[model samples]
Target: MDTNETTATTLQTKQHFEVLDGLRGVAALAVVTFHFMEWVYTDSSKNFIGHGFLAVDFFFCLSGFVIGYAYDDRISKMGILNFLVSRIIRLHPLVVAGSILGLLAFLFDPFGGHPELYSTGKIILTFFCSIFLIPLPVIADRGFNLFSFNAPAWSLFWEYIANIVYAFVLYRIGRSYLLLLTILSALAICYIGYRSGNLLGGWSGPTFWDGSVRISFSFLAGLLIYRSNWIIKNKLSFIGLSILLLLAFIMPSSKWNWLSEPLVVLFYFPILIALGAGATLTPVWKKICVFSGKISYPLYMTHYAVLWMFGNYYTSHKPGTTQLVLIVIAGLILLVGFAYLVMVIYDIPLRKYLSNKRNERLAKQKAGLI
Candidate 1:
């Protein structure tokens, strides 16, 4: 979810695993495609990319590895405050962008929705909670999602929780304690799977705590991979690893979802992360991987606004199978392009300005102290 380079003197990760970065983009694309497929296949078993939701788990695992690799040795010197500030700069710009886009889609969704049903005050309150990452699952129309305007922000909420825990607790702990915690989280994941029949319960109000469980194991496993040096040296290039990664998402759905989903989350995703970190990146694929990595977060954060529109369009029009295919294919391409535009026009420049401003303040404060 972060970048390949460390532009800041101390805040950025020293080096990135380019293959891992490229995998993030692949996961993000899978997620969007899955979202589109999900609407049509209300019974998820029929969805071709039934397991695409696991991409979020992959993301959590990758985030943990990236965070540990980036901050394990440096967080103490940077101090908790600076570390968190850096995280906010790295992550929150898109959070705000997503919220704003979600709100606009809500207010003006031409295909469907009843904006007049809610008063201005409630809408305003919901928007505030969303931008601040406060959960208010109050909108029935939006399936009582933790963040009504932006459904995917649910993961971001847990991501913030993980970041806070890292600053206050996870960073100081030894690998032994971290391993114990990871094991506990793995159990929680299994329990959730057995109880719920799948690993897909974290976005809405009823399944609120499921988000916590999902992030727990994957993120911890990721951190564990980094600390344990679990990188498996492999000849799999970016394209090879990508095809392998896509298999998990495209796997068939069946009665074993309860067991299968957790296994993938607990083991398969961690292995992918390890392989991705160690995989070779050919010179030919380096630029593609970089762009994929750079565009991933923006794509993830921004694509949902139009999802609502698509859902509305589908419900009202009930387009035929061929039309649906065309729409989804076109939607994916357009969304990717739109995400890139937003990344260039808004997210990157805003983050850069904030980073520069924060760096200057740090310099002035150091000068004053001297």
Candidate 2:
């Protein structure tokens, strides 16, 4: 390829913020734990990881910073359609994979689930909508989640939306305008938190728009962190940062969620992102951090499939305290292993194939232009 042609291709092989990647994995683990506890505890106040849902906010904020860092400069050269296809290739394969797992779990959930109640037409539509990231919350058995088959896919839907908006609107704006938007989004988050009690909307049909505001602020804050050179060089290292991130998840829930949730999302997470981007990674932790980051997304997307099954099993069997403890511990280990397998067997290979096609298509387009 010529110089111009090469410049037009994707530049995603750049080095990552390894510490941030590790924190993401930590947060993903917290989310899975939270999902498990929510089924057993029902009451947030009793759940140790009551605030685990905030991990999604952290993901959004991290996305903003990473997206800006990765694409803000190169997007102009690669163009919007190519940028989006690159995102789809990176993200959608798992979306499809997760949806399929969820569908299977829903149908064959030997523990529970009444799939026979829904017609074939409804089930088919739900599956297709999930693959396309369309919001369809009609499955009452599944808490009417926006994507019943794979509930966590709800955030991925907003993530796709944010990517499109960034390609068109976010990248071109000056830092001042970006800061202004971030502030406005922060205000919305506070209002939503105060109105509802916590930053845990956007996964269901009724609270769908609630997710929009949740992502809006966190993503903007993250993007601003990158554009404004907000990196905070620190010596806490990945271990210390992981502890700090976990505190937010394990925090006690209370009537104070309205105040505390927004504060964490609006301030604590952005600060952590900055610190994570700059924190040192010890040689001992390097491989661990890399593995954590690589497995984070797959863990986040795929764990929910088992979560539905776990919920049914929990309700049907009502395992004793000892059994519940063992089940959850084993569940965490097995889920992590499953996520690793999916990453290797399904996600990585598919993304590699799709990315190759994307490069070839770009090359052909470049030749046509020439």
- Separately for all candidates shown, the number of backbone clashes (residues 3 or more apart, or on different chains) is 0, 0
Residue 25 CA displacement from its true place in model 2, Å:
0.3
lDDT of 2 by residue, 173-277 (tens): 999999999999999999999888888999997789999998899999999999998999989978889999999998888889999999999889999999999
Worst window of 10 by summed lDDT in candidate 2: 3-12
- Give lDDT tens digits, candidate 1, residues 64-158: 99999888987887789988999999999999999999999999999999888999999999999999999999988788989999899999999
TM-score of each model, in listed order? 0.96, 0.97
lDDT of 1 at 347: 91
- Candidate 1's TM-score: 0.96
